[model samples]
Target chain A: MDENNLIKMELTVNGEAVSMIVKGGRRLLDFLRDDLHLTGTKEGCGEGECGSCTVHLDGQSVLACLTPMERAIGCSVLTIEGVGSPTNLHPVQAALLDEGGVQCGMCTPGMVMSALDLLERNPDPTIEEIIEGISGNLCRCTGYKKIIYGIQQAAQELQAASPAGTVKESVE
Target chain B: MLYRKYEVAQTLPEALSLLSSHNGAVVRPVAGGTDLILQLHERILSADVLVDISRVPELRGIRLENGQLVIGAATTYTEISRSDLVLKNAFVLAEASKKIGAVQIQNMATLGGNIGNASPAADAIPGLYALQADVVVCGPNAERRIPITEFHQGYRKIDLNPGELIKEIRFAIPAEGTGTAFYKYALRKSQAISVVDAAVCVQLSDGVIKHATVALGAVAPTIIRSPAAESVLIGEPPSEDLFDRAAEAACQDARPIDDIRGSAAFRKYLVGVCTSHAVRSACERAA
Candidate 1:
């Protein structure tokens, strides 16, 4: 019953294979923030309602607060840091800033993660899809207009990037 | 928050063994920690020990066995929604899975945990009940099966014994020709608990209801089946008048308690509306 009898677990976080052992009930969100010192993964509701703790478990977005540390054993995880950086912003991240999507900054990480996963799965999503994609995340500020528009702008930018390869193919 | 003890068994046997040693403990089996995490932080539960079943490989994946689908306890809602078998065969479950929590919650919450948690409004309950689902559990002494109807003991209570884990949920395939639908009625579209939820399974032939199963959730302490409504519609042509009568009968079992979301009166109204909608939607699918 002593939770500290830890087991060394091998996991790939942000594309790097790592190992650790803390406690049996240590939440994945806590492990990321407290152990790995990746505090970008915020915890809001702790329950599944708020998406503030969103992270990617093997590429699909999931609430990190709800994911057990043991669930991540021998699996892959992608935090907000994994997706984009300030120096090299993902299209969604860039739009969030340009479109003024950040307000309180609590829900930005989850919103961006959701949008990134959405675009990867759906190259071009409708407005309904955009709304549905971010439905789980609760943003106290911004009224979500900027966030939706940001995702739309990011989708267009991604589309614009594809035409270059298409033009090159035609020339060849 | 106060610090609490946590335990992760390397193997399920060890976990079960730990449970026997500590009787009458508040230990919980965690797949997606979403529910437990909130319960712990809120002081609703001290969480003396969180048995991390997620690390066990045995509790994962979705597979078809014989005519039933065997879902591993750790298989996330995201996986089930994307599964071709669940999409094609268990469309109701797939639909329900999509609306559960959010994409983030879907990626962590598992079907077994959903049932094991026994939330009145858990998306999987009504659909699984409509499908006439069976739960498989592995405990220290033996493995046993319980029908979904008998699974929930009360609000936030399940019949599962201590030192036991939900192994899989199984349901038989539809007879020859049939279709199903799950309807969730919440004030908001997503990321909210249901005011009322309904699932309908109907098989039709010659423009008549050959058979039907109707189930409702969140309107009672436990998920309730509308045997009265189902009886009225079976072998009879589903007409507007009949739909109205069936809905009224189903509403009888709905014991909605007043809360912030809506008044008990509204939920009572929803029982009728959701039941009718679920029936109509299911009929359309069958057609």
Candidate 2:
């Protein structure tokens, strides 16, 4: 790699402050997968169209594949791994498993990120809203009906958990 | 990586200076990177250097300047659709932005990019043409404004000079009792490129249209204004017969070609249907 092609950037990823020397052309998806070994953020098309590399950048959902390292400077990135774990899954993640929203599991991570972002913006999204919310994330399996049910379940869980009727913050 | 070097500029002058300094190099300014990044990855477009202007504070806002609604070139579609000023002043533009793609693409795509890409089927360009938007271009030497009609030269071509960045897009707030509407026909409800798009702006006084503009996209090499239709609507009362006649005139003015999306004949037929519907919608809103 040419030294001139490298640049230093600071960003918070998954609640960790990361400052490193990365190629300016390196995509956020690659940086997370290759350098950090955070393979939960899957790459499907490697293009912006697939939405398989979706992640939350500063609380907004963006395609990690199209987001270059230079754009991530001073920003906060949240990947699928950051949202939940095996033992204690986030409401959306847990609901997906219970509702059978996962099949091949390739599009699961991206779907979770997009769903969390949607619920954060609109806590109680209708079936149509949920359909549009996850329209970017293509699921070849489950036919999306289960995924819609999963998001609705998660919304109910979040509403019940929060006595004040406000949904919980996605980041925990 | 496709690009050899990259630099993120903090300001408009810095971005222009960076582009100017890279003399003879194929340097492209990237804002939102929704299209550019994909083009570079697919080898459809090449660049020796990429200057990121997405973060330039001067190129990322929406505000009313004097009587015009000024939108920074880097302002994303999500912002444009959500801006109160844009919603109130240029509702057609907001509607167009919302239909560009799904939520993720909207968050990253910008109005400047839609113009810079110069796609014949760009959802936003039709609305811009109907609204009579102006393009603000700043280069190393000077800044100039180009009307949207003249801004596009040909297929995927723009009139922008080297080292010149699109700074902002401005369109006057329509007069009272005026209504504008946009309609797009695509392969899918979301994440689909437009097969045919139409936008209409109509101003009414005394129950008759005094001013009208109809712009159609994807049916020609560039988004085109239907002066034939506009002339038909002027001085005519809001009526289905008048709108149908105007739509027929707009269809006569369209020059579409056969593409995978649609046949030229089908697009020509759609031109009339879309125009009539858009005109009816605009007239209802005006009333």
Candidate 3:
């Protein structure tokens, strides 16, 4: 492996366009955490089995650990850090906190990302739909009961905020 | 590092050239890279050059041509599950694709990667087998087509040559009076590997089974079709007794072995149960 073989990629992360020289084998999870220091996207399994590395790649939820950095080239990436802020929390984030969905906190970021994507697609998802939407995410401590409630609460909150059923843009 | 260099191919020809240029290096064509990335991390597979085909527009789309459903190899499971053409013409494939992993995995995992990986427990293979799909491959010199049934030579072994890539998978639209169904018996409702899965496609005419195809997975070295069971249904009238016999024949066709997923006996039992369920569902759909 020569340094010259490193692939150059340009991507938009958290609404900021940037360029980097990444190794061919670098996983997106590693790139987000190491290069951008977006450590909010936790790595639970380092495999696609656990959804802890979930992120929005061009507005679709994908597992970062399984995604090669090259795939992110010329694409928009939305990680947990970009989803919402501490003071102006996204509805999903606020609902998770209100519902006590953060037990271990290891899977919260990914869960939030998944739930947000779910709400964006199905504004008024039923309980079953919410469970199915976030089925990929694994939470060991909350036993999924609080997580489901969090998504339910977020759906209602978002619907109330925007009667037209549009997710408020969380990007700052 | 599992791979030293990454090259993106904008076209099929560009990808083939890259493969030939790195002829001696361990070059692997990656689409979605859902399985390839994990394999690289686990040291299960190593490559010097990884040719990224995810961006190749030529290798992505779902369309109907001359009544045949043609799907590009790079088409993701999410795309397949959401495609109306697939849902109407090949509903079993859509059902199988929907059950593969979860939303993230469905978004990232490609049908070609699923076939290329050749996991016995892969959900799409059995459905493709039942649909009688054809795999189209291209290399530097020429292109070729292979039947999906003959595509797998053994466990994890495919009929693909070095530098050759699967371009598309095409199958005939099931004719009128035909019904198909796919079933997988996994441990969990989502993101679980199949312990035993079955896909059944049958055509009924004048209350008699005119045609039948039953494919089973996770119980053999490769996705296996139960010709014996299919033979039993060819001329028989649809009945609980007939389905029972076909299910028995399907169980006999399965060569399951004890593994972490299940015991051999348990898998064999599932073959019978799933086969029966699939056949009944297909029959109901057909009626």
Q: Using DockQ as the measure, which candidate wins?
A: 3
**Model 3 steric clash pairs:** none
* Candidate 3 error regions (>4 Å): A1-5, A22-24, A165-172
State the DockQ of every prediction.
Answer: 0.49, 0.59, 0.68
How would you encode candidate 1's per-residue C-alpha lDDT over B15-117 as one tens digit per residue? Answer: 6776666666667777776676777766777866577676566678888889888788778888899999887777888899998888778777888888887
TM-score of each: 0.89, 0.95, 0.96
Task: Judging by lDDT, tell me the better candidate of 1 and 2.
Answer: 2
DockQ-derived CAPRI band for the predicted complex in model 1: acceptable
Ranking by TM-score: 3, 2, 1
Better of 1 and 3 by lDDT: 3
Tens-digit per-residue lDDT, A26-119, candidate 3: 8989889988899999999987887999999999999999888878989999999997798999989998989999977999999999998888
- By lDDT, the best candidate is 3
- What local distance difference test score does each model get? 0.82, 0.89, 0.90
Could you arrange the candidates by DockQ from highest to lowest?
A: 3, 2, 1
Screening candidate 1 with a backbone cut-off below 3 angstroms (N, C-alpha, C), the clashing residue pairs are A3-B6, A66-B33, A66-B34
Error of 3 at B174 (Å): 0.9
- Candidate 2 residues lying further than 4 Å off, grouped into runs, are A1-4, A165-172
Model 1, range A17-104, lDDT digits (tens) per residue? Answer: 9887665556788889988898888988777787898888888888777666766877899998887787998889899999999988
